[model samples]
Target: MTAIAEHKPAPPKPGTGGGDGGFIDLVLRFRELTILAALIVLVAVTTAVNPRFLSAQGVEDIFLNASILVLLAVGQTLVVVTRNIDLSVGSTVGLVAFVVGDFVTNSDHGLVVAVALGVGIGAVCGLVNGLLVSFCGVPALVVTLGTLYVIQGLNHYIAHGEQISAAEVPQSILDLGNGAILGVPYLPLISVVVMLLVGYYLRAYSSGREFYAIGSSPEAARLAGVPIRRRVLTAYLASGVLAGLAGTLWLARFGTVIADPAKGWELKVVAAVVVGGVAIVGGVGTVYGAALGALLITTIGSVLVVLKINSFWQEAIVGLLLLLAISADRLVALRLARVLRKRNARHG
Candidate 1:
């Protein structure tokens, strides 16, 4: 009988580059590139359908419309990066927006104070969610879902069916949303600034890395002495503060606040983050991607208008885009898994 060679693993590849590793690194690190390509495609298509879609005013409209979602998505990205979710953002924004409106209309609070109060309230809500998730060891989904209803109910009770109209809002506060700097809307500018800071922190800071580490492998991060609990709590708190800021912007832009100002917004924010290439499971996304995702979602609505399609199709299109994005993510995961297995066998 012929002697059979033992089942030995192959030798490691020579170069540190090439094959699946490089591809995955490119996908993970340059997710923004994909988003940019998608955005370009969207713009091109829209412009083809309606040249007016590329007008300066049209561009401004898109950016302004996308700004709030961008802000919300950035916060969602942070929490999701840590393998957590915050379903309460919509309710948080609603509550805070109404609070700001109420303060501005019913009290002697200045614009600055009103803005601060809204953000503070949001931060406090976030802290509660964070504490429950971190200290109580509750899953983020369950915790946030519970808070979502609780916060919404609280908002309804506080508003007591009251609504603040544009006539009642201060000019200064409205300017926060309407004002433009260097020809760009202030809200979009603020979103850009926030994105820059968040992107830098995630890319360069140790604490920020802890989020990725935790998401990548919680057990490993814990063993490596990462303060998982504290960081996670901070993530949720940051999300809340951002949501509050978004609420204030909503108050300014809409010039009115009701208990349901941002109903169902949390889902949209999550969809934007996920569509932008952020991993739903966590630890693999960027602020840039989240911002791009927001832009893309906003563009979709504009595109629909340009195409003169029914407004009803907007939600359906968004759902379709979300499904495609999730499918793409699943494919990427499968390819990465295959690559890892092959590499392990080679090294074994």
Candidate 2:
């Protein structure tokens, strides 16, 4: 008679260092490498179709366009790493953009004050989300969704059918948005700096790795003495602050704002994060990968324009890419499950 083995899978450890950690490191690098390869192929194909697509301005445009999404994706990565989501970020961005733009225009505030206001407002929004989702024990999805509607309503009431225009915005703020330094645009530069900082933190800091542990297995993480609630709250707070910063930059970039600015952007940001190799189910991904994903999405839009393809197809392509990414994640999960089962059987 053959004896059946009971299965038991070990939970991932925060800041783990061993064969397992090395394997995870390899997976992370591989995911980012695949994205870079795809991006290169995309750029090459589009440039082949239209030489002008590879022009200096065209490249800069792609990065500038991706800057906002990259920032949002970085913040989203932090939240998602902890098995949480912030649906309110889109609305938060819209509110900050309009409120900061209006306040700056009326008060003639300097760039520093405008930025401070945007960050502060975003922090308030994030704090509300963190408090509710963390201490109140509400589901993150439901909490963020509710906040989304509430924030959107508040923005509409404040705007009152009015919009901020370039004429009303200060030159210093506009310059920060549109101006380039040493042949590089400020928008993309800012995004790159944020991405690097986040990527380093996630890889180098114990608390940051705890995020992955929490997402991988919250019960296990708690058993390991990790402070799950505090980390989750911090994630939402970071997401909000980044969204707010993005809003202020949005005003500068466009020199215009409406109540509905950035409406329905949450989906795009999620798509970018997921496509960047972050599992929707959580426990894996990097800001570097997420930023590359943003760049890829932006490149796709530019590719359509340079190819003179129908604009409608852009959404279709994005949807298809999202499906593919999700499928890829599912496959990875299956493989991981299989590996765990094998390891369990060996012990059994």
Candidate 3:
């Protein structure tokens, strides 16, 4: 009888059904699960200390407070996943909020007009940053940092130290921000909708996968014919558009706008994204994880107040969590790489 030849199956691609793909999916899910567990434990401990911490209203408040940050964090994830950053987002939010708020306050523009104006302004800002970083060859960090200051300065110049008060905001806008359906607040509901939509797109589309590929290895992605400039521009634009929407929501939620309404918020958004398991060096993360990170961070602040802990401790705790997340991500990446190498060797 002729000798039979054995044929081994080829290794699965990075995002396919088996091998590296499965392992990566597991790790990503685990990161989100870890954050969810921490959130649960935190709520349990806080509720134990103060039962009111878990009250219906208190729970609603937590979601409500996290809504804006969650939106910002989701936006940031798009850019970070592409190995880029937008430090101007906070300034963008502040500028959009003030400009939109002022326009609505002074004009008879309806909600649609207000929203469009906000989004348009944000897109313009994103366009500027994208052009500089993607086409002009400027570093993302440097471009966004420069735009951050420029936007802040423009906001200050326009505001002239003026502020938009609750009395000036339209009741309709306020309702959109504060009203609810089925006992859930509108702010949180809107945020959740956006998060779900984005998460789906990123997971289900080829373009979405390209973002990860570009972040993972830019040279490889380029070699594979991915449109690097277009994708990066799209990421920045998405982030800007979301920041604009968040600004509109901010105005509605607070019925107030100042020149520096979202000052220093960019750092918090970065922290949330990092803590949510997004690798700082880029290429791995999800909007779901980023949203959970925002919620967890927001909850921590609330917990500290409810537990009567020093406000100062809140920053320290967040910093510690940030460090832990970075270290964990680094270790996990190294280990996963090693495992994959070993597995491939054995297969060979």
Candidate 4:
């Protein structure tokens, strides 16, 4: 009886994800669960300290602030998952923001044209980064870093020590950024739509899955005839376009285009993606997770303020959280390995 009991199959791990179990597994994954729990705890503590933190205005502020970062983080997820990075996104946004503002200032190119211009400019930047990395065989880090400076330099030169003030911006554009539908802010709504579209493609399409394949094992991806070069290029282009859109929104939301608005934003976006549970190593994370990561990062800043923590401690706290997230991932991985080994040993 004891032997039979010992031989009985153990129930599957809660989120091991087999067949009908996939969605459950996704929710229970250590990384996703950690971020969600941390966010909840942080929110609760902040609300306790100041009930105003959960007020409608406060909630709107958190989501609005998170919108651009969430957009950028989602795009960055695709690139990082494939073992690449785009440091140029910050510069891309700055340049496009100023340029779009400048364009609309004199010509009145209309909102659609202005947005197209920004996205096109960004796509061009992404294309350059992609070409150098994919065809020229340059390291992605080096390429994007160089592009970052090059773009920022261009933006500075174009601005010529001038700024695009709110007076110069079109009201319609600002309305798009500031307006709400059914009491929901447009910025967050825009972010949600982009997130859903990208996430769906990544989850439902073969080409999107190819990105995961490339990140997992480039050599294997090559063997499997994955179009590595094209995919990398597309990834960068998507990132650039999103950054550009963010820049356009930046202009709309702030109505003051400085050459340095998003100067150091790339690091924050990367932090969100990492904290969201997307493996920095490549090929293991969801855009939804990245979005949550953005929300969590944004909320932390607000919570710190609500709790009256020193402003200086904000970045430090973010850094600590990132470290904790990575460590948790490693611990979970190690635990899984041990479990597998023990089970194999018993079977043997």
Candidate 5:
């Protein structure tokens, strides 16, 4: 009898199927689910304590307050996912806010034009940081840290201790902040659209996958034919654009802008992103989670006020939540790593 040649089965991809892959997927999916559950619980508890918390007006207030931070957190999530950080966003927002205020007060610019200009300026600042980091081979952290000072200084010089009050802002612009659509605040609605766009891009696009790949393993992504430099630059540019957009929202919401607009906001933004489940080391996270995080933190602050807790507890509570988030991240990471190792061993 003639012997027939037998075909061998193809090996599974490193991050695919039947072994550690399933476990990893389960863990990641669960992490996101858990975060959602936590948010729901928090909302329920707060509403229970103060029934007014569930009222339409109260809900709108919470969302509106979280809107700017949500924007910042989303941008921060992208940067952090690429294993980089943008420390200048707070300052960038401040600079853009001040610039918009100046245009409105000192010039004859319309509200729409001023908003566009502010966002445009923010994009430019982000572009500068991206170029320095991507082309100059500088660390993102360092580049952004420097830009923070530069942007802040520029804001101060431009404002020259000047402040723009509500009177200076056009009624139309201020209205943008308070206006609602189908019972939803305009700011939050805009924020939701932004988050949805970003979520779809990251989850459904090839370029978005490349971002996760680069974050997962930069050298490997390069080896796999990913355009490392181009993607990194684009990531930073997107971040800047988002930051600028956030500044416009900030200007509208506050109806005033000063040299110190959004001062110390970067930390809060980062914290929100991290606590929302974005990995600090990169290659993992969802915008939905980050948005949830922003909501959670915002709610916490509101809850404190409603509960008549001292304001000092706000920082302390945030610190505690941050610590818990980091700890949880580490535990999840370790578990995933262990599962991977075991599967590799079994398959080999």
Candidate 6:
């Protein structure tokens, strides 16, 4: 009289070409898809509310408005992909931007040189951040936070209550920012080119993927001889350079500069990156997605305008979107942890 034992189902395992893994991949892609859908819906709703919202000029304004954030978002994507953050980007942009007034109005340098100076200054700030974080073994958040204050202090000290006015700015440069080529604003076009190039690198290069590896598992990445420090430093440097570049463009677009220009943009850029679906935990998002995230944020503001939402509610909406993104990231982490545990159980 033998008793038959019941067979138990196998535990689901991630990376086994199984349904669970496929679902995770879908989740990763879902963020981008959601952004696209939201963009379409926002545009549709806004256009319905105000048909002029879809006007060609209005569309151009949206893209140009998003360009700076998009640049910062891409740079942030690089850093975040490696489990790092650069809180100094906004301050860096501000500091470099203060220089734009000097260059545009005081210096003999043309637009190109002005832009180069901004980038170089940004790189220096980045170098300070990178060296400290990599060689000093400081936590990235703390290091960036420290740099943020240092840079902001420097900005205020240098400005000493000075401001860069539109009359002092070159009309040529301002026109460059506003001018469209084949119907696309220059700023957005520049951003589009940058996003495409960065996206390609991340998608196609082995070294680019190293950023993800480091973020996915720093210990494992170190063991694999992935040169984690170098990658992380490079990420921060890239962030600085982009932020600086954005600063130059910012001056061009606005024709005005103050000591604290872009002072609050650091949070916005980080929010854009995270909301764009680049995992704050690192190694799971794209520059295009980040750019889309920037576009979505910008669109939200426009949507509010079209719908005549209270100005007070704008900040709340952005904050709520950011919170939602953070929550989504946390949920993704929990899902991954559960999958990893199941995989372990299957093996055990």
- What are the RMSDs of all candidates, in order? 7.1, 5.0, 5.3, 7.2, 5.3, 7.3
TM-score, one value per model:
0.91, 0.93, 0.92, 0.88, 0.91, 0.91
lDDT of each: 0.84, 0.86, 0.86, 0.83, 0.80, 0.82
lDDT of 1 by residue, 1-348 (tens): 222223322211111112354665577556668778878998998898788999999998999999999999999988997889999999999998988898898776667897789889989999999999988999999999999999999999998998989999988889988998787789999999999998888767777777777776676567666788998999999999999999999999999778868999998999899888787876677778888988988898888888989988878877887898888878887887888899899999
lDDT value for model 1: 0.84
Pick out the ten consecutive residues of candidate 4 with the lowest summed lDDT. Answer: 11-20
What is the per-residue lDDT of model 4 for residues 99-152, given as tens digits with 9 covering 90 to 100? Answer: 999999988577898899988998899899989988899999999999999998
In terms of lDDT, which candidate is stronger, 2 or 6? Answer: 2
lDDT of 6 by residue, 104-148 (tens): 698666788888888999888888888888878999899999999
Error of 5 at 215 (Å): 0.6
lDDT of 4: 0.83
List the lowest-lDDT window of 10 residues for candidate 6: 8-17
Q: Is candidate 1 or candidate 4 better by lDDT?
A: 1
Better of 4 and 6 by lDDT: 4
Candidate 3 per-residue C-alpha lDDT over 1-348 given as tens digits, one digit per residue, 9 for 90 to 100: 212213322222322222266667787788889999999999998888899999999998899989999999999998998889989999999999999999999988868888899899989999899889888989999999999999999999999999999898888888877899989899999899999998888777878877887777777677666788999999999999999999988998888888979998898899999998777777788888899999999999999999888988988988998999889878877777898899899999
By lDDT, the best candidate is 3
lDDT of 5 at 299: 87
Ranking according to lDDT, highest score first:
3, 2, 1, 4, 6, 5
Error of 2 at 204 (Å): 1.1
Model 1 residue runs over 4 Å out of place are 1-21, 29-31
Q: Write the number of the candidate with greater TM-score, choosing between 2 and 6.
A: 2
How many residue-pair clashes does candidate 5 contain?
A: 0
